[model samples]
Target: MASRRTTRRLAADAGLLVVAAAFVLPLAWVILSALDPHANLRVKTPDGLTLDNFDAILTPEITFTPLLNSLILCGGATLLTVVCAALAAYPLSRFRSRFNRPFLLTILFATSLPITAIMVPVYALFVQVDLIDTMQGTIFFFAASQLPFAIWLMKNFMDGVPKELEEAAWTDGASAFQSLLRIVLPLMGPGVSVVTVFSFVMMWGNFFVPFMLLLTPDQMPASVSINDFFGNRGMVAYGQLAAFSIVYSTPVILLYVLIARRLGGGFALGGAVKG
Candidate 1:
């Protein structure tokens, strides 16, 4: 039995390694393509590997304007989503209402709804308001779209927390908001981090909304800008496209790694302080 269990564990580990490789292969290809010297506007790969693609993206040949726009939009969307989630979660978690069950269910239902169903009305409204080519408008759209899931995730996490902490804080002369800021927010680190990561990734990766709403090419997100690497022109751009994609995805990869590393450390620290 012991030997069988060990064999099963080894098999599981091998299976996971295969899955990880499958997920990583595309990224590896992108990195390799970016380094290929033949990557360019024409139909032929450059003779050897070079950093020219990175140079073109970072320095002159290709402008960083789209990257800058993406950063601003993503930042705004994250702030909006987090704040809205925090506020909504507080009420939903604490309040007992005859309507609470239905309300929570509705939020879950809304989250499952696809964005495509609402795009037509959303687009028409944006047109009426003259917000067709702006970062603020894009941020607003992203925030609204992300709100339901953020609220649900936060509320579910908060619901598991005990009410006694808040009562004690109140008895000690702390206001409701103060108790929330001091007692509740500290315990909500994991959930908040998860929601923030999801919101940032979604807003950063979104291409359809940016493409439809941003009339000016200057306001395009990096996700949309990547389309320029390919056109009626040819195949040589594939190498450059690969390189650009690798660069674009690097920040997201780093963000995920940083979050994962901090998650356990954060919980440990919080536990120590509480003890």
Candidate 2:
């Protein structure tokens, strides 16, 4: 029995290491490709290595407009999603309404629904509203898409928090809204941070919606900018494209690393112990 258990543990660890490598290897390749001047993304041969690609993209002529566009869209969308989800989740978490479970289930269903399924309708609606190419419109669209999942995650985190904290605040003449603002929201920090990060990443990296809706070249997101770098009609500007990708992706990676530490324990259930 002991031998079997040891074998299983070894196998699990080995499997996890393999999985980790699988994920890391692609990112490593991206970094290498970005540095390799002779690396043609269109035609991948094994031997090319150089930093000219990074230098070319970082040069002032390359411009940082795409990076700025991504920041605006992601920042606006993330803020909107977190605020809306927090407002929505608080009531659902505290109330014992007959519709509460059904409402949450509906949100779960929405989260699972593929964005492709609604693309046509949403695009048409945006066109009708003359919002197809605007940053504000895109931000709202991204916020709405992320809200269901954010609310669900936050509600679950809030559920694990004790109701008595809010109740005690209420006894002190705090309004329901006040109790949520002063008591509950402060405690839901971790889960909210996770969802905010998720929403920001999604909006930042999204390509399809921006590709289809944003007609103007100037309004394009970084994903679209990268696609354009490769050129239309299958032309590959390998060096510039490689550089642009690295420049755009670096800030995203750095931001995640910075935010991850702050979000660590605040939202977890173990952090919910009475203070």
Candidate 3:
């Protein structure tokens, strides 16, 4: 029995390694292609490694402008989503009104609605308001779209923060808003971090929204700008595209590395409840 269990454990580990490699192999190919000067659709070891692919693509007009545009749009949208979600979540989490349940259900339903379904109306409204090709308008739409899911997550996180802490704060003459700022929010850091990262990632990877809304090339984000690497009539710069992708993806990778562990370390609600 002992020997059989040992064999099964080894088999499981081997199976897991295969699963891991399946995902890692593609990422490995992209990195290798980025370094290969003559990289094509087929990824292979560099015939002669060179930084020229990166150099050719890195320019203020082509790369930096779109990169900066992405950062601004994503950053602004994330900030808006996190703040609004937190405030909205706090009430939903703490209040016990009959309307709260139905309201939250509505939000959950909204989360499943595809953005494409609403784009026609959204674009028409943008036209009426003269917001076409505008960064602020894009950012606003991004935040608004992400708000339903962010609020749902925030509310669950806020719920994990015990009401006992707020009760103590109330005893000390602290207002509800004051308690939220000092006690509740501080304890829900992991939750907020998750929401912030999620919002940022969604906006950063978005292509269709910016592609449709932004008419001026100068206003395009990196997600939309990368399309230029695919030229008209059967031409594509694979090496340059790979290199640009690496640059485009670094911020999100760094952000996940920084906060990923905390994202799983949700509030120890039991301790707060006991306190």
TM-scores for every candidate against the unseen true structure: 0.84, 0.81, 0.89
- Model 2 misses residue 180 by how many Å? 1.6
- Model 1 TM-score relative to the real fold: 0.84
* Candidate numbers sorted by lDDT from highest down: 3, 1, 2
lDDT of 1 by residue, 1-275 (tens): 99999999999999999999888766566766778776544334347878887776674224477778888999899999999899888978998888788988888888889997777787899999988788899899999899988888888778878999899988999987887788887888877887788779878888888878787877778888778766533654767677778777878877767666776543533342222
Return the TM-score for candidate 3, rounded to 2 decimals.
Answer: 0.89
**Clashing residue pairs found in predicted model 2:** 35-50, 36-50, 190-267
Evaluated at residue 135, the lDDT of candidate 2 is 89
Off by over 4 Å in 3: 232-235, 264-275
lDDT tens readout by residue for model 3, 121-190: 8888999999989999998999999999889888988999999989999999999899999999999888
Which candidate has the top score in lDDT? 3
RMSD of each: 5.3, 4.7, 4.2
Q: TM-score of the candidate numbered 2?
A: 0.81
Q: What is the lDDT of candidate 3?
A: 0.86
> lDDT tens string, model 2, 1-275?
99999999999999999999888876666666776666665435436667766666664335477777888888998999999998999889898899998998899888878986787888899999999989888888889888888888888878878999888888899998898888888887666776777678778878887777777888777888777665663767566675677778777677577555665633432342111
Error of 2 at 229 (Å): 1.7
Q: Rank the candidates by TM-score, best first.
A: 3, 1, 2
Evaluate model 2: give its lDDT. 0.77
- Scored by CA lDDT, what does every candidate get? 0.78, 0.77, 0.86
